[model samples]
Target: MDISKLKEMPYDELRVLYKQHLHSLNISKATINTASVDTFYLWRKDSKTLFWDTVLSNDFESEARSRLLKTLSEHSSGNVNALVSGYLSHLRKFRLYISSDSTWEQSETNQVKTEKNTNLRRTKKDIVIPSPTVEQVEFYLTKWDGLENYHLQEDALNKLFLELCPNNTDILDILLKASTLNDFYSTNIFSIYPVAKHIRSLNIDTRLDAGDVTLVRDIQHVTISNKKRSFYSFATKYCSHHNPLDYPIYDSYVDEVLRYFRNRDNFSDFQNDELKDYVRFKDILIDFRGFYGLGTYNLKQIDQYVWQLGKDYFPKNYGKKKRGDK
Candidate 1:
């Protein structure tokens, strides 16, 4: 943390400390490894092609800056400026580590490294994830209100359900439509009828209980091709579409967003696994609202806020990821 001490530390020790610093900042193991701070002694090399061109120069432009600034700001020292200066100095040392055959070349490397680190330091000092505020939430809500495509689709689906699935008397058709529109592909085609029947049996209209959500999720044990499948996320979405006020939807985006904030803010005390439980997930969302002074928003508003925030900040690798992946 004391960037000033980086120069004095041994090469191996610097690698360890840098890796630990990244872990403390909650950077993924994959990212830390790819940075190769430990694997290749990235800090000891003074080439732009090393960590800079490959990792820091390409991905997570805003995220890296924000996280670094936020971590330093929250340090016990509470002197963001001094800490960032130390960090700049450390990066300078990194760029100055070139081994050249000639003194002139080494001098050129030192000059370039000094210039790059000076710019890097200035940029790092300005990096920040603007603190959450009521105005910012309202801005996002307004943005949500102006949306056209997704909202139109959602509105149409809600309308169809209003006309067809008012009370779940016979909702197999409506359920199928909902699944298609919502991309609930995890549920088997044949299993939809049984899930609908199960929901009809519960008669979960106008109100929803925690047990109701759990029962809906657990009751479906249909096996197709000897593969047992339970539509837990789909079940939550189904119940939420029915009663948005009582049931908050659960999906990977929501899950990641919750975990990110929980790690950063300590808003609530719950395990990551607890998010799978509808009761606890809803409670955690409530706690998030309270912690951020977002009491004016309802559960649905909070859901929209966090869902959009997740999509923006923690996007999925869409080419390799699917719904329900954590």
Candidate 2:
């Protein structure tokens, strides 16, 4: 639990560490690496790490941690899987005492292969849904000539959801549920409410537009600290788009990754797919996803593992710094 080491090491070093520490494949019919062990030793020499650390230092409350983890289980499967595999990679890399033949990377590959494997399916409940062709997406999206804004929103939402959700049933359920919200913004278009105004301005390119968001100073004053009502009012603007779900609500993990990259590139905010670095972020994420089997596995799980892996291994650069900029 040396927070400093976890927060200071660059990913390249961490990647090597990953290959050393947990190198062996913990083949369990029920779980990959049961109990989620902290196998690697982070070099924590002092207590000055909190300047950037959050969960690792117990500063984040139980509620925050729970919400973060739940976000992984629900909205971000991709992050969870990234954490798991990356952790396994870290273990295999550092703990050379374990063995040299531990190609943990292959183990990760093999795990996906095992899941796809008909032989494994006969014994497991895991479901691998094929990504829908764009034709199917176009059909579903255009089937109903909804409002122009609704159509635009739905298209964006569909692409985001379908890309993230691999389980067919899960994907369909999410889309169906989201379709109802298409009209949520239509009625609010002329409303002067800050939330409404923000929502009206949010399109794909305007996603990062801070104008759509308002940080209200709702927290009056709680000098009592940690035990206050801690009330701060923030409005959820729907924007010109149909729904917020289209862009995965950058959860704490996502926030961390995004911030790292943003700060490294010195970007104060991102408003749309055109945020000078969108392409770069897309490429980095795509490469990472391809390295693993994101196209095949549950998108949420993949997200989880990736974010966790980044945090666990690339502590210094994981969520604090990124290089690419468009």
TM-score of each: 0.55, 0.24
lDDT of 1 at 280: 79
Model 1 bad stretches (over 4 Å): 1-131, 171-174, 181-191, 206-227, 319-326
**Roughly what TM-score does model 2 have, to 2 decimal places?**
0.24
Candidate 2 overall lDDT versus native: 0.32
- How far does residue 150 in candidate 1 sit from its true spot (Å)? 1.1
Q: Compared with the true structure, what per-residue lDDT tens digits does model 2 show for residues 1-326?
A: 24345457664464455443322332231122221222231222112232123233343344334433443345333444333333333333333432334233347776566446534323212211111222222332343344365456557555553444322234243343233232332221122233222322332223333322222112111223233322111112222122332211222334344444333332234543322232333344444345333455333333334344333323342333221100
> Cα lDDT for residue 104, model 1?
21
Residue 175's C-alpha lDDT in candidate 2?
40
**Candidate 2, residue 184: lDDT:** 36
